[model samples]
Target: MSGTTWAAIDLHHHVVPREYAKALSKLGVTEGLGVQLPKWEASKALDVMDAHGIARSVVSISAPGVYFPAKDPTSAVAKQLSRAMNEACAALVRDHPGRFGVFATLPVPDVDAALEELRYAFDELH
Candidate 1:
């Protein structure tokens, strides 16, 4: 091997965007799948990535996805929340280009809305 090193790309990284956390708090959900949510900050995540020799991390939301409790996943609220989360992730990628990337969140169970978001995430956000 040559005297060169390559950094790793983490595809399964998780991120709890600020707006998403606030929405969850409003819904009285402090945990996901019965486990408490862990604190997250982009700076901290970047620091950890640097320490681990990770070149980039593709961040996405962790479970208890978009809808919560008895809320219908097809509802407007679900679409709105998904959009907010995706936008927040986009912002992270925007703020720290090359260091972060996004796995856009979709409002699942709402096919039309999901399609719309897919288009927006690709055409607009990209």
Candidate 2:
């Protein structure tokens, strides 16, 4: 058996970019899951990864996803939020070189927006 060791890849990493956190704050969503959203720093993330021997991390938006104001069944806000998060992720990947990759969040229950975002993320962002 040829056993080759490779650096760890964290598939479930979450990065709440500074801009995204501000946007949420503007929307009055200060907390989710009964706790305030914690601050995140890209430099801190890299440090932790380095300490833990993780070479790459695929980042994604956390729970409750892009959808907000749950009463709005149209998912309009979800689409907008998803686009912002994806764009931010793309920027992070651009800035971090090989250290980060994106899972690409989609605005679910809104098929058309999701499809459009999928195309943009794969074609342009990647």
Which one wins on TM-score? 1
- Model 2: lDDT of residue 101: 94
In model 2, pairs of residues that clash are none
| TM-score of model number 1 | 0.93
lDDT of each: 0.86, 0.83
Tens-digit lDDT track of model 1 for 46-119:
99999999999998998778865375534777888988988888889999999998888988877888999999
Judge candidate 1 at residue 37 and give its lDDT: 83
Give the TM-scores of the predictions, in the order they appear: 0.93, 0.88
Cα-based lDDT at residue 93, candidate 2? 92
For residues 59-114, could you state the per-residue lDDT of candidate 2 as single tens digits?
Answer: 99765467775555778777878888999899989999999999988988678889
Give all candidate RMSDs, comma-separated. 1.4, 2.1
